[model samples]
Target chain A: DAGITQSPRHKVTETGTPVTLRCHQTENHRYMYWYRQDPGHGLRLIHYSYGVKDTDKGEVSDGYSVSRSKTEDFLLTLESATSSQTSVYFCAISDPAGGQETQYFGPGTRLLVL
Target chain B: EDQVTQSPEALRLQEGESSSLNCSYTVSGLRGLFWYRQDPGKGPEFLFTLYSAGEEKEKERLKATLTKKESFLHITAPKPEDSATYLCAVQATGNNRLAFGKGNQVVVIP
Candidate 1:
């Protein structure tokens, strides 16, 4: 109940189309992360931000990009969508000062590209 | 490389039955371990955090114990609503990154 919301709960797009998903947090946490989950394979980190204007790629950073201009908003964009990118995307936030080292997740956004 | 492996891909238990789920992890320098529960079509919910070996934590009917190599989540007298996927993740020292295991799927039948 830390006030995290993900926009466009579900989306369907065509291959090669550009798509963007939004994640908003009201708690103003310093750390934010983007992850994708698929069947049989567990969740994998896509990108993370340590502070405003500071972002780093994860293991599966190919074909995806993220930006955090404000502390409350983190955006994930797929430059050119691919069928392989179809999965459930999640956004999480954490505060290391308030014992917030543990990440809390959003409701999730399900995406399908055909 | 940090790797995590969970055993018993899927488990089915009847109401009032008790069982345990296993999470085995291999990290270069262990910093922290976490447990999460997730339902179908939803994001994961945090359950516990273990920092050192021989550490144990409990909540309601769930108890988590961590050792040097693996961790176990024990459920006692499970109910029908206890069915969900349990996930394990480990954070390495000096890095703000976490490596997660695939997870253990548990189903409690009424």
Candidate 2:
């Protein structure tokens, strides 16, 4: 899992409810990413943050939002959770310096929307 | 649009068997290709990164090679413990995001 950790390893929530997943990293990497893994869809990026307070949407950013208030924390929020949003969420960190382009991932958070 | 496609959704091999997994991509401009191994219920673990065509990388029993259109992850004499889903992702130039393939689920029977 590298130096990353995702809170709420498992959660079951109702549709239309709001949910937030937290990703914390001790690696102090410059890039942090949020991704969702579902069957038949490997891993789709939801959002990413290049630096503190700097964020951008990813390929599948609709219905999701992200915030990076500090160097170690990046939060993904689902304003109104939907059944389609239920999936295993993963957080990844990368430092491209020194040719280290590989991203390290956290254990992941499993979210179930009913 | 950048896309990655992995062949053979699932694979089964006996222990000590050798095999290869393929990852083909179509991106605007290639920046890097990445390989990862993921266990059940866990996040992906990084394995190797190939930056250009004809580049190769190796670990203990795994080797990754890249061409202009695709990449191959060759497992030499794999073990039962090596059974896991292998994922492939590619980064396009001028894009900070990676496009991933559905992954190849491998089961090495002992």
Candidate 3:
């Protein structure tokens, strides 16, 4: 409902392979975040971008990297896939200018590593 | 470090029954607390944002209330559609990241 979409809704890759997921938004939001959801860990932030070319690491940033070259697109890449990296990845957007911290999420992407 | 803990990992309620979910947290400086509902195989949907103590927000049958150290989500006359996992998260002052709880799973039988 937020005009956000994640490409490759599902993916299966072998270990040691590189995988990249894409998140695209049409709301022109200033804040974009990438998170992973596991059985007992809830949703953990992997990385986030405040603006074009501005990024920061989150609680679970290991084995993952993110880049935002434009306002509407954010990308998350796994340099080398691992079995432990298999989880559901989500993308979210927020507008901080209006003092709104509430984040709207996309559908999500499920990744499997074997 | 900010931490959020949710009690009663799972719950079951009959249609038309009322219940509540608890979310307790500890943060350096409270900026806001958020409640989200997540369906199976889907991303979380934002429900409410509570800024400070003594604040309450409502949408339909769901009501969220916040205090100094915790928050509660009360459901009145719940329906089978309310069955889902409820997640709670906290954002601290001067921090843009959120700390999340494991979430509480609710199953409302019709």
| Model 2: residue A65 alpha-carbon error in angstroms | 1.0
lDDT of 1: 0.93
**Stretches of candidate 2 exceeding 4 Å from the true structure:** A97-99
Model 1 residue A23 CA deviation in Å: 0.5
Give me the displacement of residue B106 in model 3, in angstroms.
0.3
lDDT measured at residue A108 in model 2 versus the true structure, 0 to 100: 96
Q: State each model's CA lDDT, in order.
A: 0.93, 0.94, 0.95
lDDT of 2 by residue, B9-109 (tens): 99999999999999999999999999999999999999998989999999999999999999999999999989999999999997778999999999999
Error of 2 at B77 (Å): 1.0
> Considering every candidate listed, which one attains the maximal DockQ?
2
- The order of the candidates by TM-score, greatest first, is 3, 1, 2
What DockQ, between 0 and 1, does each candidate earn? 0.85, 0.94, 0.87
DockQ-superior candidate, 2 or 3: 2
CAPRI grade of model 2 = high
Model 3 misplacement above 4 A? none
Model 3 TM-score on chain A: 0.98
Predictions in order: chain A TM-score = 0.97, 0.96, 0.98
Of candidate 2 chain B, the 10-residue stretch with the lowest lDDT total is B90-99
lDDT of 3 at B26: 99
Q: Of the candidates shown, which would achieve the greatest lDDT relative to the real structure?
A: 3
